[model samples]
Target: MYAYQCIYLADVYLCEAGKLLVVPMDGSHWFTMRSVVEKLIERGHELVVVMPEVSWQLGQSLNCTVKSYKTSYTLEDIDRAMKDFAGTHWTVRDDNMVSLWMGSGYNFFELVFSHCRSLFNDKKLVEYLKESSFDAVFVEPFDMCGLIVAKYLSLPSVVFTRAVFCHYLREATQCPNPLSYVPLNFVSSSDVMTFKERVWNHITHFQERLFCHHFFKSVLDFASEVFPEPVTLYDLFSHTSIWLIRTDFVFDYPKPVMPNMVYVGGINCHGGKPLSKATKPGSRTQHGYDPLT
Candidate 1:
């Protein structure tokens, strides 16, 4: 019976053994993607992570192949940009808010696109991708670089996000995004928006669209050199198999979602280890919780 069970497990493992090409945005985005990678590895799938040199150490620790590429920006650059723009008092009404959003978006796009361009220039990486046979590409579609790369390799792609809502992804999927009721991610409003808030949301959504269009136009122009003829980011994204969003209705406002969009909120919370003795209920001391005890 034990031998039979072992054979059964081996067959299951063999059945589940498929290669995945994971393309994640740099910096804290890796932390968000880490759980997904772990889940894939647990399910017996091989992962090929294409990341910046700074995250090579992290990739080395994972049970998968790591492809490191040199990039002009580092995690520190992202951190600095966030710190410069992020503050408590900023609001949609503030003039500086627009500047903040624009500046931050530009920095993020520059970093992501620059890294992607570096990967495109890497002959060895390109050759390896061409040779590799992946079941699917798992990507954080911050820009369409992941989709472009997946197109180059002729693999199906799955786009995932840690954000509550992504306007670009919504547009790509042609998902319903009613600005009247649905607040923009940057806009601090609820599902039941006031008249003024609804108007503000519309304006913000328009701005976002314009910003993305300009940036994506430039990205696609650069991508034409790397991707084959008759390729567009919209086409690539529309054909994606699924979008695993890290949000749930409980924590987020009600909104219409497409069939391909899967709400995987609290995926990281599930199957997590229980709290230790010190943090567990009734384990706290008068002085404080003693983890060593």
Candidate 2:
């Protein structure tokens, strides 16, 4: 086994060289997963990326084999959703917050699912994957379609989420999530929570879990109709080889993580040239800071 180390990216262990099929959710997600794909390619692993046509620039820059699919929703739909959410009058009240969250969730889901549906219907994409003898599949965990494709191809799958924490992936991996101390994503709470805050966290966590469960269930049912195999979404997720979460203690609060759940946070951070002594504060050169003595 070979282990590579870096200051920003997580330490990855590779036992052998093989081709990896990368499936990114959308343009934004393609940008997030770009570094990972690039690292794999640098390690002499072949890569095949499947992404939305909106990310054609990214695919072209990667200089790898790519299969781009068209989506029904346009960039305008995304802009509208952002405008609606940002334009809303936000408040601390439960009703107002809940309304905003749910509305945004629905709009985002519609946009994502529309793309997923289009990817499923692309016979050429499906045929390409069927013919490509990929060793494993690397999927962004935004949609279940990638998991379904992995199942259809009988390949081991790994999930890489750009978020600090993904509740669905955590739950699927049976990781310990003590809601009492672990705050929900966007809940604006520290590791230690007050009694009332813990209660609120529990309620919000439960609500999100319930909503996502049903949402994925519907997606799974629709996928089942199109794919020849009859596997539930839960099965596909539960069997995932690893869940790569983008997080690090440098910025994130402490939390429990399972063995399979690896934190690759700060993987995007890159180093630059050091500050020259001439440019340093209290130096004599131009742009240098002057002492107040």
Candidate 3:
């Protein structure tokens, strides 16, 4: 395989009017990615977004070719899942590590598996995608279907995400995130941790390592049918060309970065807006940018 360039998810320089295929995750994740899609459109990039018909935030007023596919899930299933997910923030209880560690994880996985299975079942779409001759794929890690598609098409996959789940980032990118200093996500500890916190970090990290395969089992089963060779999420991810993380140093602690990983964090953040009478003073500063004098 030819070496891939480290680039932004949106602004990859290509032949004029380069074609891009997008496989986006639903809900708030789409909100972050939509700005990138619009900017690409503004730059005259032809984009085709393939998404399930039953989605909360997709199918909006974006000027792109949106190809919808049927899924086993319905709108109500999505809403109910979202409702339960959001409802967790308000309903308080004792800290159950098992419950808190995997809040809404199974629900999200179930939906993703359903979509992945249905997407492949639509044999025509799969065949069309193979024939599209697209340049690259933009995908978030939460949805495994996009990765599967990239593998199927032999296209270079660009991952646009905050972080891969369960510390798969380390395995996939070969980037070192030391257990002692780099606190595992979901544990919520900073780079520096107390002895007890460090111990808890190890515990949490170990659990995810053990259970990660279980989380990915359903989708991997679909992958087995599609490919002659055995595959796993790790195999799909190891082929990623660019990793466009949605965080900057302002939002994330300093850590070791790999060559192919780019932090286009706050790339979605808009630039300065003119201050009017309605604009509160220093509001821009509060939002991480200084307002002009």
Best by TM-score: 3
List per-prediction Cα lDDT, in the order shown: 0.70, 0.70, 0.78
Report the candidate with higher TM-score, 1 versus 3. Answer: 3
TM-score order, best first, reads 3, 2, 1
C-alpha RMSD of each candidate structure in angstroms? 6.1, 5.5, 5.6
What tens-digit string does per-residue lDDT give for candidate 3 at 1-293? 11123345576743456778899988778888888888888877778999998887895998999988999988888777767766665653423334642477468557756787788888898888888888899888776888988898999888888778776778898998777777776667888889998888788788877777777777788888889988977888898999998888567766788999888867667797863443565566655456684
Tens digits of lDDT, candidate 2, 1-293: 01223344357643556778887765566666888888888887778988776533347678678888887777777767656755553533444345654576556666666676787789988898889888788887666767767777878788887662236666677878888888877588888999999998988787776666565655777677776776565666775777787766557666777888777877767865564457555566534434554
Candidate 3 error regions (>4 Å): 1-15, 91-97, 101-105, 276-293
Task: Summing lDDT over every window of 10 consecutive residues in candidate 1, give the lowest-scoring window.
Answer: 1-10
Candidate 2: clashing pairs of residues: 247-265
Candidate number of the best lDDT: 3
- Candidate 2, poorest ten consecutive residues by summed lDDT: 1-10
Q: Give one digit per residue, the lDDT tens place, for model 1 in 174-195.
A: 8888889887776788899899
Q: What is the lDDT ranking, best to worst? A: 3, 1, 2
